[model samples]
Structures are given as structure tokens and as C-alpha cells.
Target: MTREPRSGCPIASTLDIVGDRWTLVILRDLLNGKSRFSQFLSSPERITTNILTDRLVAMESAGLVTKSPYQARPQRFEYKLTRRGEALLPILQEMCLWANAHIPGTWTPPVSFMARKPE
Candidate 1:
């Protein structure tokens, strides 16, 4: 089944693909090089297994993430961001900077995080 576009605006069009909360969180982890399922699970945000599984599948279907098998016996999957997904880093950085400046008591991420070039 195909999903309809949320809006005609470019920003909205992009958000239609990655606006969900879990999707961004998943993307954030992937940006940090957290490729393994268990590593995503162990994040400070503590995502549930079922939700994580569903989000990963959705992202894969959306062409934002690609899943690859690392082991054959039990079949493990690792998630990595596609170029489209990696393109969100600048947006994420802007949001983080805005939150840090405008929101009270928001912990700041490292300067390196804000300055790091996308791969």
C-alpha cells in the first residue's frame, strides 16, 4: 500500500516521510552509528522491542533505512540510514540548537555533534 503525501510544501513533504517521533529517534541512533538492534534497544530513551521492530520495518519500507542480516543462525538485522535519511542531520541540528537556546533546562549536545559533517 502507498502512503499519500501530507502536503505540497517541501518541508511538509519531507516530514511526511520522517515526522513520526520514533522515526526521528531511530534516525538519531543511526546517525550516531548505532546499527545493531540491541544497541538501539540500549539507548537512553529505552524503546520497547515491538515498537522498535515496527519503526524499523516502517523506515525500511519508506526507503529511509536498509536492513541487513549479520548472522544466519538466528537471523539478526542491523539498521542503517540511507542518504535520504542522513539528509535530516542539518534539520536535527537546527532543532537541537533552537531547543537549547529557547527551552529552559535542555541539556546541550556536544559541539562536535552540531558541527560534524554528514557521511
Candidate 2:
């Protein structure tokens, strides 16, 4: 697969992979320990199946996530963030903190959860 340009600027490069609204939400859900396909669907954001499928596929192609079949027969897939994907924890945490501080009625995440070192 052809890789997209990710170095027009450092931030641009980072955004190129995880910049879209849904992409970040996906990452956030994963960081919160949601791994299964249905779990992602059940997020409060209520993402549609088609969009979720597309985003998950894109993320997999971008090396941010991996899909493994955990069931036989019809086959069921579970999504897991790769080490590269986990690297975005700091970015997600910063954004979440900023939103909670500046946005009206933003719910605060657990301080301990945010303080934990990224795996």
C-alpha cells in the first residue's frame, strides 16, 4: 500500500494519521480499553458501523491498529492498538485535559488514569 505524505510539517505528519474527528475518537475508545468491534460501536459517540469499519481498516493500514480473529466459523475480529498507536496516549491525554479545562461541562477523566504511564 502507498503511504501518505506525513512530513510537510511534524504536526501535519502526526495529524495525517490521527487528525480526523472519528480517528481520535477511535483512539480514545481504544485507550479506554475498548477492544472488540461491538464495544467500539457502543461508544457514547454512537459511530455507525460503516464509518467504524472504514476507520478501523484505515487505522490497520496505517499501522495504528491490528485485527485478529478471536472466533471461528463466521470469524470475529478484535481490534488492538499497536505500540505505534499507543504512542498517541500523550496526545490524547493532552487534548482531553485541554477540553476538560476549557470546554463547558466537559467531564473530567480520572486523574489516576491520566497519570498512569503509557504502556
Candidate 3:
């Protein structure tokens, strides 16, 4: 399903880039220091490999991440958040705070994570 871009609304434009459920989860994992594909697979939600690949590509294309090859034999890579992606950390924290307040049984984010300043 394709829709015309809404250039006027900042929120809508941002959502158009990172609206998928997995994108934010992937970003959250990156913020937690998970860099490898296997590490992302270890996330509790157990995202499928295919979706992860697609999202990573989309994110890279959007300048949110950059993947550096870590192993030559299999071309293994580690993904890191770009400055733009790192800027979303506070937004994610706000979401976490909102969830903790409204959702029963929601796990509280670590104090260290909430307290740390973005690089």
C-alpha cells in the first residue's frame, strides 16, 4: 500500500521512515549495544531474519545506520547507529516511560540506560 508523502507534518514524515514495529525495536536493541545480526536475533520478540534484513537495508538507506564488515570470510557485519539514529534515544526513553506508566507488568528500563547521555 502506497500513500502520498505528507511533507507538512513532521511526525507523519518521521513515522513514514520508522513506523514499522520492528524498526523501533531494532533501534532499541542498537541503543542497548547490540551490533551483530545474531545479537538482534536474541531479542525477546524473536524477529525473523528476513524482516531484519529488510529493515536494516531500509534504515541504512535512510542514513540511520551504517554496517561495517567485521569478518572477511562470510562478510559478517556489525551495525551501528548513525548520529541521526542516536538522536532517537530520548524519544525511545519517553516511550518507555509512557509504557511503564500505562502498561501493567511492563518491565522498567534500567536506571543507567535512562540516565546515560547520548553520544
The candidate scoring highest on lDDT is: 3
What residue pairs clash in candidate 2, if any at all? none
Tens digit per residue, CA lDDT, model 3, 3-44? 455786989898988999899999999999899999999999
lDDT of each: 0.84, 0.87, 0.92
Error of 2 at 9 (Å): 0.4
Candidate scoring better on lDDT of 2 and 3: 3
Task: Give a tens-digit lDDT track for model 2, residues 30-106.
Answer: 88889988999999999999999989999999999999999998898989989999888898889888998899898
TM-score of each: 0.89, 0.91, 0.93
Winner by TM-score between candidate 3 and candidate 1: 3
TM-score for model 2? 0.91
Candidate 3 colliding pairs? none
* Candidate 1 wrongly placed segments (more than 4 Å): none
Error of 3 at 30 (Å): 0.6
Evaluate model 2: give its lDDT.
Answer: 0.87
Worst 10 residues of 2 by lDDT: 1-10
lDDT of 1 by residue, 26-50 (tens): 8878887799999999998899999
**lDDT score at residue 51, model 3, on the 0-100 scale:** 99
Error of 3 at 36 (Å): 0.3
Deviation in Å, model 3, residue 105 alpha carbon: 1.0
